[model samples]
Target: MHILNIGILAHVDAGKTSLTERLLFETGVIDRLGSVDEGSTQTDSGEIERRRGITIRTAVASFTLGDLRVNLVDTPGHADFVAEVERALGVLDGAVLVLSAVEGVQPHTRVLMKTLRRLRLPTLIFVNKIDRAGARERELLADIRRRLAPSCVPVNTVTGIGGRAAVTRPVGSTQEAAEILAERDDGLLELLVEGGTPSADLVRAALAGQCGDGVTYPVLFGSAITGQGVPELLDGIGTLLPAVSRSALPDEPARGAVFAIERGPSGEKVAYLRLRAGVLRVRETVVFHRGQNATYDGRLTALSVAGAPAQREAVTGDIVRVWGVPEIRVGDHLGGPGPAGQAHFTPPGLETVVRPRVPGQEPRLHAALLALAEQDPLIGTRTLAGGDTSVLLYGEVQKEVIGETLARDFGVEADFEPSRPVYFERPAGTGEAVEEIQRHGRNTFMATVGLRVDPAPPGSGVDYRREVDLGSLPPAFHRAIEDSVHLALREGPHGRPVTDVVVTLTRTGYSAPESVAADFRGRTPVVLARALRRAGTIVYEPCHRFEAEVPLETFGAVTASLAGAGAELRDTRRRDDTWVLAGEIPAAAVHEVELRLPGLSHGEGVWWSEAAGDRAVRQSTATR
Candidate 1:
């Protein structure tokens, strides 16, 4: 049997979970169908996910479709959980993009479609909710072509009669398909020019082949709730989408990527692995490679698949939940010796300080949060000087959800302060600072180092180089200085994370009265701080780039609200009865704007924002 690792994705409330349930039921993977409304989904079993009726984490399930083992990943649709979507994208062989026919293409739909094309993943579009009163497949298709992608070709069309499923035609003979096929193939183009018709087998073969080539997309219409066109959808999954290639011989070494880290039912860390070569066996030690000359070895104690019993081994092209590897992290490569794949995620634009509601629970709260951070590294938690913990968030909803999850999962009641926009510090000028071992009286540490701080371009990030001769200082001492440089930059003079600067060691001298690596490492921070103080630093607040669609009558009010929030309007255009406003706004004001948008536009507005990096405004006088 072939293995198909697929992902179901879409905008929020587009029936992605509903479609997942339907697929599982149709394939006989479940004894009964589970409803998302009731929170009975096999994948969305988390308390927070069920309570909010939204998927915050990616969920996996398995099913069989015509002798094919389909490993399905159900991903969150809300833009707030884009990190979850990104992780799922890395392991998918194909995707099913669910769309609400009534709403057509949305902001997130466009975002996801762009990523799908960028990754060159074969995608099948499911126009869900066709049974609704105002669902128009034709108009939706046109909108998809104009806004999403031009390569979308319809494979099935819905014929609704009085809000009921009338029929669905297998759309084989169409001018659009013929044109797309002809454009891709010279023989088909020549035959079409000569007024020759291609057979059904030839057309189907061309369509299926081009889908995996990333140039063609297949569209299928159905109501997942009513099971309309689900069989055809299954057929499409089995036949249209490409399966994982069995290129690795059985004798090849084991290889896989860790896409997720989660605590299993027994409260132990479980590494969700996707094996691409060889086999993973129980009790066998696996090597994890994370690139920086870092490698960890852990034994696989147990292996299990979604919706399946525990297995002693998992073969090539399979996903398994492996236990006994507590050190495994997201993006770690197992068995194979190669650089870990980078996760595509935007940095958190908003940050909030989380405090324990109960007194003296700081340690527990910190440990719980640290564990959560390990599972979702994008969360970005930090420990402040006052022992308060700050967590980076995507939005207010995510903040609330994270707070609730902490209380429920870890029993740590917490409260969050008003969110602050995360800022980065950069050097405004260049200066040098020198530290001499003789300056410290009665101290045995013997090291002398001179470092220079220089300004770099906005996005250049922090860089360190050695300007002094190699033999001037012992290699251990030099290594300690380099390590201390990185630690010192974590919190700059302004108490913000530093970026866009270059720090170079200009001079190095060490006299060992009785010295160790710690001597050089310990004193390096003081010298680096002195240099940063002399160089001076500026704080830059992140800005969120926004695109809003508001009714024409509410345009003035919407623009006024945005202006009140320190937004800089970049462009404005009219789209039928609505106005499309594009601009950048202070990240600090995003939560306020989001709260007021629905009321301001009378629920007829749509807006989305993404991090626009940071721009320097003024010097930060505040210090931590």
Candidate 2:
């Protein structure tokens, strides 16, 4: 059977979870429809998720579509959990971008569509909430074309919109669909220009081909609450999206990625693996590649293919949950390397320290936070100079969720300190340092290390190289030095990660019998730190590119508000009664601006912002 892995994505409160429930009911996967407000949805099983009525994690469910088995991945729509969506995107064959007909295109919706197009994943747009008051069709489509994508074609028509009797009917071969296709196909455009109408079959073939190529997007109208136009949307999913079918050979090696990690009832790690090729069997050992030079091997103690029990083996295109790989992490490649699945989103720019409220539960709180980090790696945790632990966050909601989860799941109450912006240190100049093997008191270890630090272009991260010969020391010793270099750089002189720099091993010396890997690991950091201090470092604060649309009358107030938040305006334009302002702002001030925008414009303001890398901190305002 063909396997189709698709993700349901949208901005928060766009009825993404409700749509998932409706699809399950319409497909006969469930006997009764589950309500999000009633906390009965299958995808949102967590207590906090049910109470909050928001999806905080990606949920997996499957339904059969003819001969194809559809693995539907329902991802969180809230911007705080975008990392979950990013992980889900790596394993999907296609996606459904859901938007509310009332709210139209939102900030997060634009971000998701940009990423989907960047990955070239075939996508279908679902205009949900058609039965709600103030729902729109033609105007919303126009907004989508202007902001999201121009190739979006409505494949269905809505009637009695914005009322209880709202419904949609599938339309055959529309002129807009033909025109959208003609732009991409020269032959088709010539036929249309010559006054010849293409046959319905010809138009469909072109549409399917372009949609599969991720150029043309088909839009469908639906109301998940009332089940209006759901069947038509389901048909669009199976017909317009692509699926993969592969037969794995007996001797072929396994190739897949771990997109998510969950803890079972017994506290054992359960890894969600999407098999791209080859076969995986029970009790078979597999190698997980984390990066270029790190690998971990573990045997599969148990396996379940597509949530089916009694399945001993899994093949290509199957999403299986495997046990016994405790070291496995999200984004780890299983068996052998194929695509690296690079991160599509930025890391959290804000961090806060958390302390156990009861004082004696420090260890428990630390252990629980580590487990949470294992599940969502982007919520990175680190121990501060004090005993408190700090966690990275996208927004305040995630921080709240973490505190609640610790109390509920781990039975540990925690208090979070006010959040602060996470910063980075970049090398300001070139410098070198050397420590001879037991020659000086500073070099206590039996290994000598020499290193140089130089700045690279922004966003290049850390690059490690060797100026010394490969045979200068044993391979294990060299590996130890390289690993130590990366680990030590995690905290620089300013207590921030050092990035955009190159480190070279200038010299190496080790005794044949006395020198060990431990000696190199112990000595490398000291030398590298000295070199970094000599090179000096500059601090940079994360920034975001923002776009704000405000009522024309409130332009002065909005601009003043943005300026007060340290925003640098780039352009300003007038759109009817609204003014659009585009520029960059400090990530630290993003939340403040978002909160004040509505009040500044009397609830007529719209805002959108995305990570725009980092900028050098002004010397006058630099703080640790």
Candidate 3:
């Protein structure tokens, strides 16, 4: 047996917390398995995390199984709280993606699998809550194989559904394990040809290997509440998961960057750092910023592991607590105990701005929000207008949590406003546009520039290239054009930041040589602003793929509501007695649509949304 850094992930309310509880109790790690519904589980430690019935943050706990040490991270299953999972994965070697046998592959499930693939991690699947109505192991297993890695195979199955059932290791031997061994390895295929059974070690090795290659995954199932298959699940965990005990930073000064920073009620800041490539020792002075490498100015007050306070230093595999550091941030790299790679935790689909709703609390509110953004640098903050601010986040629950944290932790009750997502809009066809730059001065700076705007693919982001070779123009002159285009994009054509388009410069020259400073700086912005006004611009709001679970009868209403909101429907199907609606909606319309579905469906839908950014290739800017 060996130690493993494993994470428990799943769709919201798919019995993930229950499964973790069962593992703790049955493995003798805990005397009793507490209920999440009752707000008594060990892993759902925070009050906010518990009350939400979701793991808002990652929690690490240690358990012993035979000779193996299981360092488990119970993570949030919701998409908005995905940053929690990302930071958690940085510290994990393996994962347990729990699904409901009653409700198969879900959207969040897909997100987790993609994240796992991106991380190139070993994985085990658990189809829990089989006792629930509409349970279908075979169908769900097939869906898992299709949506996730093809290597997924159920190693265990419940002999009976739910509470009274016994667990059986379906992949037992040569004949029994055929379903799992077919595509495992070349040796496995040979063993099958010879009618031989590979040892359990061989299977584990093959799975680990395939996982390392991004090829396969091992899956199992059970009902966590009845304690069914609990021991076998624990056995599999000890057998297959990787060790975390020896995972430490190198034994010297290292760069550790913050992925998450949390403040407890006691006003202590806990920075979660990934040791990039060095060792951090206790009571050592370290740098708290990525750019200020020459100056290591913060002290390592203390280090803690597995939720307990300790004086020992931290290393790579160790995600420890470091206190007494001010101005430390989520993306800031630190050098002290260990060195860490430079990594930025940019939460996906960020709106790039955060605004406060309180009056006269602007500066204080802005200050606190900025601090929060600094702590979790993924929460990008920017001011698009003089009095308007935007705080970027991965999900709405985070928005709520952040608001609540501000209210409770910082004494500011700030409400959020709808964000205008950024898009780079361009014209569909190419054309030359001209404008005269008249700096009403001694010399009028009239400018004529050939500009072409073209449509780009969704999510390619904005790109500005000079079709005219830099060598054709003065070096300093060409650079000036690039600088001002940035300024123009930041403050759009009509004076609003542009979205969903690409702006390219074909040619530019001043009205006369004396009209310019002999450099393009004299005509850059004027030329840029000219082409921008002449080149047509269109508007594109942020789009998101959404999934909603509601009562069976509400499917039609959900579809209707989504269609009315200008969303493109993907799939609407029934899961047991519940309806799952899949579709794409403009980001601005989601909040309203999400709030109205349940009421519109006559209180039948328990709505939740997961939006992936869908930007248009090109569009003209709408009036601001």
**Of the candidates shown, which would achieve the greatest lDDT relative to the real structure?**
2
lDDT of 1 at 353: 94
Model 1: ten consecutive residues of lowest lDDT: 337-346
Clashing pairs in 2: none
Best by TM-score: 2
How do the residues 1-624 of candidate 1 rate in per-residue lDDT, one tens digit apiece? Answer: 578899999999999998999998888888788888899987787988887788888888999866688999999988788888887887889999999888778777888898898888999999888888888877788899998888788988877622776457788576668787778888879888998888777877888998987778988988888888788899989989999753447577888888888887779998887888887788998788875446999998888865356656787778888889888888778875554334355567799999999999999999999998877877888898789999998778888888888999999999999998887788989989997776457754577778999999766667788898888877778889988898889899878888778999987777665667887887788888999999998888888878899999998899999999989999999988999998889889988998899999999889888665666665433454
lDDT of 3 by residue, 17-70 (tens): 889888888767789878888899988887777777777777767777666556
Error of 1 at 167 (Å): 3.4
Q: TM-score for model 3?
A: 0.77
The model with the greater lDDT, 1 or 2, is 2
Rank by lDDT (best first):
2, 1, 3
Name the better of 1 and 2 by TM-score: 2
Instruction: Evaluate model 1: give its lDDT.
Output: 0.83
Q: For residues 1-624, could you state the per-residue lDDT of candidate 2 as single tens digits?
A: 788899999999999999999999898899898888999998999999999999998889988888888889999988778899989998999999999999899878999999999999999999999999999999999999999999888888899999989988877656677888899999889998998888877877887788899999989998998998888888877888889994687788889989999899999999998998899999889899986657889999998877455768899988999999889888788887646337778778888999999978888999999999999988888887777899998877889999999999999999998777888899999989998889447646999999999999876678899999999999999999999999999988776789989999999999879889999999999999999999998888888778899999999999998999889999999988999999999888988888888889999888878666778887655545
Residue 332 in model 3: shift from native, Å? 3.5
Candidate ranking under TM-score, highest first, comes to 2, 1, 3
